[model samples]
Target: MREDFGASALLKIQELERKGAKLGMAQKILLAETGTVEQVLSILTGSPIRVNVTSQSEEKGVISREVVLTSDAGEPLIRARSKVYCRNLPPAVVEKIRRKRLGIGTAIFSAGLETFRKITKMGVNDGIPYRTYRIFYRGKVAFEIREEILLKGGPGGI
Candidate 1:
C-alpha cells in the first residue's frame, strides 16, 4: 500500500479496535494480504461494532462514560472508554465515536437526531468517515458485527 493508503488502512484498523473488535495476528496478516487499502478498509469496517454507555450525576457534577465492544454476546472482544464532557457534542466524543470508544448504537443515542443529521451531512462529502481509535484490553476474536450501516456510518454519525 502507498504511505497514505497504509495510513488510511491503519486508521480503519484503529477504528475497528476502538469499536471493540478483537483482531488476532492472523487477521492482521489477512488485512495486509488484501493489497488494496480500500479492501482492507472494507473488511475492518463493513459491520456494526458494539459499545456500552454509563452516566451519573451528582450535586457538583455530571459524568458520562462509554465502553465499546465487538459483540453483544457473552464477553466483549475488545473495549475502549471515554468521559463525556459538558459540550454534549464535543469533537472528542465524535473522535471517540470514530475511534469506536462509543459503539454505534450508543453513539447514535448519545448524539441524538440532530447530531445524526450533522453526521449524515458531513458523511456525504467525506466518502466515508474514517477514524483512528484504540483498544484498552485485548482478547481473542469471538464475533463481528455484520451490518454495513454500523460499519460505514463511521464516528461522525455513530
Candidate 2:
C-alpha cells in the first residue's frame, strides 16, 4: 500500500511541474500586457489615474486604473481595482499564456503535495503528536503562498 501511494505521489508531482510551466507562461503574458515593469508597478500602486495600452497601430489594448469611480448621493467615489482583457492581447498569445499558467499552477500543487507527504511520513515514524503535525501543515500553506508570490514576481516586475 505504501509503495502504491508513493508511486501515485510521484505521478502527481510530474503533472504539477507541467502545470506550473503553463501558469508561468500565463503570468508572463498578463504582465506583458501592462507594457513595462514600471507600468505594472504604477498600476499596482493605487494611483488615481487611467492607463490605456495600445498596440503598434495605436489600437487600444488594455486599460488599467487605480480606482473606478461611481456616483452616490451626487458624489463620486473611488474603488481600487485592476483588470486585463483578451482584446488587448493577441489571441494566439493569450491562449499560449493561459496554457502556461495552468502548467505552472499544476507544478506548484504537485510540489506542495510532495512536501506534505514527506512531512506526514516523518511525523508518523517519529510518533509526533497529531496536533503538531496540524500546525506544520498550516505553516506550510502560509509559506507556500508567500513563496509563490515571490517566485512569480521578484523584488521587481519583469
Candidate 3:
C-alpha cells in the first residue's frame, strides 16, 4: 500500500469512483477470491492473461517484483507487487521464480506445489481499490502480494 501508483492510474481511479459505478460480480469475486488471481481474472474476462514484470529486485533472500497482469488484448487488468521469501520455497521452484517468465501463481502451480492464499486486506483506500494476501507453501509463508485492479471495465464496470 506504500507503493506509488503513478499519477495517471490515480486519476483513473478517482474518475471511476466519481462516476458512482457499482461493483460488478467479477469485481466482487476478485475482492473475496483466495485462489489464483490470474485464473479468476481470465475466467471473468473470458481471455487468457499474461504477466508483465515492471521491476524486480532481490535483497536479503527476498525477491520483490512489481508487475501488471494483462488480458489477451493487452489491456492491463491488475497491478501487483510481490515479495517472495526464498527460504520458504524449494530450490527448483525458486529457480522458476527467478526466471520471472511466469506469473507467481503459474510458477507455483506448474511445479505442483501445494499452496494456499491468506487474505491480509482488501478495500478501497484513498479511492484506489486493492487486495493484499500471502501465499503459503508447506505451511510456510512464501509470498506476500499486493494487487490493485486497474481495468476500467473492472472495479465498478466503468
Candidate 4:
C-alpha cells in the first residue's frame, strides 16, 4: 500500500460531444480525451489513489509489471499491467524518471506519440470486482497493456 493516499471522491460526469458519456477505463481514454490521471480519477471516482505492486519482472526483453490502483480507503479502482521496452526510450529521460510513478498520459508524453494499436480483448462479469482489457501499441509491440476497472456496484445497478 502507498502511504501517499489522499481524499473522498466528488466525481461527476459531464456531457461530451453532447453524447452524455461517462469517464471510462484507466488507459489513455481519460488521459487523452479528458485529462491527467489525477484529474480523471478525481472527476470519475472522486478519490485519491494508492498503488500496490502485484507482480513485476523483466522477461523476453521487456519490463513487465502489474499494479493494483486503489482508493484511500482501500477500494480497488483499477488494476493495470504493462510491458514496456525501456531500451526503445530515450536514455537520458529513462535514467532520471522513475517508471513506476508514471501515469498513462505521462508515459505517452515521455514516449512521444505512442498510440494504441488495438483493443485485443475485453471482459466483464457481474459477480466479479473487475473488468479486464488487453491493448497493444504499434511497432514490434513496443508496449502492451492489460487493465481492469475495479469499482464495485459497477456503472449501474445492473
Q: What is the lDDT of residue 61 in candidate 4?
A: 54
Top lDDT model: 3
Residue 3, candidate 4: C-alpha displacement in angstroms:
45
**Each candidate: how many clashes?**
1, 17, 0, 2
Clashing pairs in 3: none
TM-score of 2: 0.16
Off by over 4 Å in 2: 1-83, 101-158
Q: Candidate 3: misplaced stretches above 4 Å?
A: 1-22, 153-158
Summing lDDT over every window of 10 consecutive residues in candidate 2, give the lowest-scoring window.
Answer: 142-151
TM-score of 3: 0.81
Model 4: lDDT of residue 19: 38
Question: Would you list the rank order by TM-score, best first?
Answer: 3, 4, 1, 2
Tens-digit per-residue lDDT, 7-125, candidate 3: 43444445555666445546556766777889998888789999999999899999999999999999888999999999999998888878878899889888899898877776675
TM-score for each of the candidates: 0.29, 0.16, 0.81, 0.55
lDDT score, candidate 2: 0.27
The per-model lDDT (C-alpha) reads 0.35, 0.27, 0.80, 0.49
